[model samples]
Target: MSGRVSHTVDMSVKLGELTLRTPVLTASGTFASGREFADFIDLERLGAVVTKGVSLEPWEGSPSPRIAETPSGMLNSIGLQNPGVEAFCEDDLAWLSSVDVPVIVNVSGHTVLEYVSVIERLEVEPRVDAYEINISCPNVDSGGMAFGTACTPAEEVTRACRAATSRPLIVKLSPNVTDIAEIARAVVASGADGVSLINTLLGMAIDIRTFRPKLARIVGGLSGPAIKPVALRMVWQVAGAVDVPVIGMGGITDTEDAVEFMLAGATAISVGTANFVDPTTVMRVTDGLAEFCRTRSIARVSNLTGAMRT
Candidate 1:
């Protein structure tokens, strides 16, 4: 027999006051509250289930042909379509309450008041363990600028949500900004417990045959492996800039991708676009992480956070 010593690796991680069983979480908009993917994998196996963006009122969303495939990536402009917070509580939150895993609702709105309203509505629900403020939604009152793109608006929205609930607050930052770190700092200063980043880069595609734009909106949010490099860079920057935990997500598909993010200073990582390619990707990555740590005799997976060598 080989002289390899067995080791038990601890996968639990802490984000503010919240403790996650593992670092692997389901990115919002991809998992859809976890009920849809329950048949393929056990929901309890994930660190957390971040639900799709929910607003104060129902959003009609963008027109059809809002999706397009590109090299190593895909573009989408779904517009955060949802049945509003009240319906979400009646349906998604009700179902999630039965699951053992933590639920982090992705709150969206066109104004600061709308953001607070969504959190206030969800505050009554016992199922919600945390809140991931999706500031990627356009600020209609601010001339359509995404709340996550600017420091002032980002802080304004985050502060309002912070006052609305005492739950763990994590703001999802947009990559379509001049300096993502500045926006992250702004949100944290306003009272965000943690931050999740690289929410798809703005991109577009055109159909040569039809001589038209592939997506109906002319441009859409790009996700998948194409953005992994950019995502890693931003995670490194924001993680260093902020004292709070950083949830890195962009094109993570496997165990190595998750490891890379952790090394880049992410306290946790989220699986997004790859969920479409493999329904069991999150579980596979979660299990793989344990095996990876055991092989390295790391003892605990938390040691991998920001362990990168420059």
Candidate 2:
């Protein structure tokens, strides 16, 4: 009975040439290279592990009190803190190579050359299966949201990175843009194989008693359930605009949320803040996707993409 049920639905998804065993991926900056959550959930079960933002050099990041909890979500200004690309390969990549799942490195840099350099360095590493260019990070003072918010810069960065490596390139998009679909088109036209969004909305909070900003950065990126509606809208719009693939993420907390993204035309979905709430959120959503399809008699989960009725 179990064997028959398992074969009833196909959960595999393709993002460009990279094939994921399932459509569920962990959002960058949340899973921390998959090692921390390995004990809580099986790393092999994940469709792919997206590591935290890794720059060409180590980033000191923002000062303390960079995180704040709000009504239905949280704000953080981590500024893409990491041990740099070289150290990351020697340590995180080396360990991740042994795991059975695919590793998608999140590349970060202050310049277009820096982003290209990071990819060039990882090209020789056999463990890296793909690259997620994080041009949409809002916390950093420079190069984060700067490259992603506009078409010219977004295209320039995507074009440079595209020339750097043949590995699957997925550009992470910022929701702060005036028109996210335009940015998506810019990246895709510049040779991006896929695009992931909506990287936290620009948000802020104030400590009423102290009469000071809640976060040291004053304005940080807001994530979690608060942004779900906006995220879904952008995902739908981008998916309709782009021909490659759309990896949707933002406030996804459960199986139904994942389904909503797929129906909105997301080729794959990533779990961000939910991982902090429950380490097993990805696994649960992954399993739930299969069950969701099985019960609906949908032979493949891919069929769910863009299935929403007009």
TM-scores for the candidates: 0.96, 0.98
Q: How high is the CA lDDT of each candidate model? A: 0.89, 0.93
Q: Kindly report which residue stretches of model 1 are placed more than 4 angstroms away from their true locations once superposed.
A: 1-7, 137-145
181: Cα error in model 2, Å: 0.7
lDDT string for model 2 (1-310, tens) is 1232367798899998988989999999999999999898888878899999999999989997999999889999999889999999999998998899999999999999999999999999999999999999999888989999999999999999999999999999999988999999999999999999989999999999999999999999999999999999999999999999899999999999999999999999999999999998998888888888998899999999999999
lDDT of 1 by residue, 184-263 (tens): 99999999999999788888999999999998878888999999999999999999999999999999999999999999
Report the Cα lDDT for residue 134, model 1.
89
Candidates in order: C-alpha RMSD to true structure? 3.1, 1.4
Q: Which portions of model 2 show Cα errors greater than 4 Å?
A: 1-5
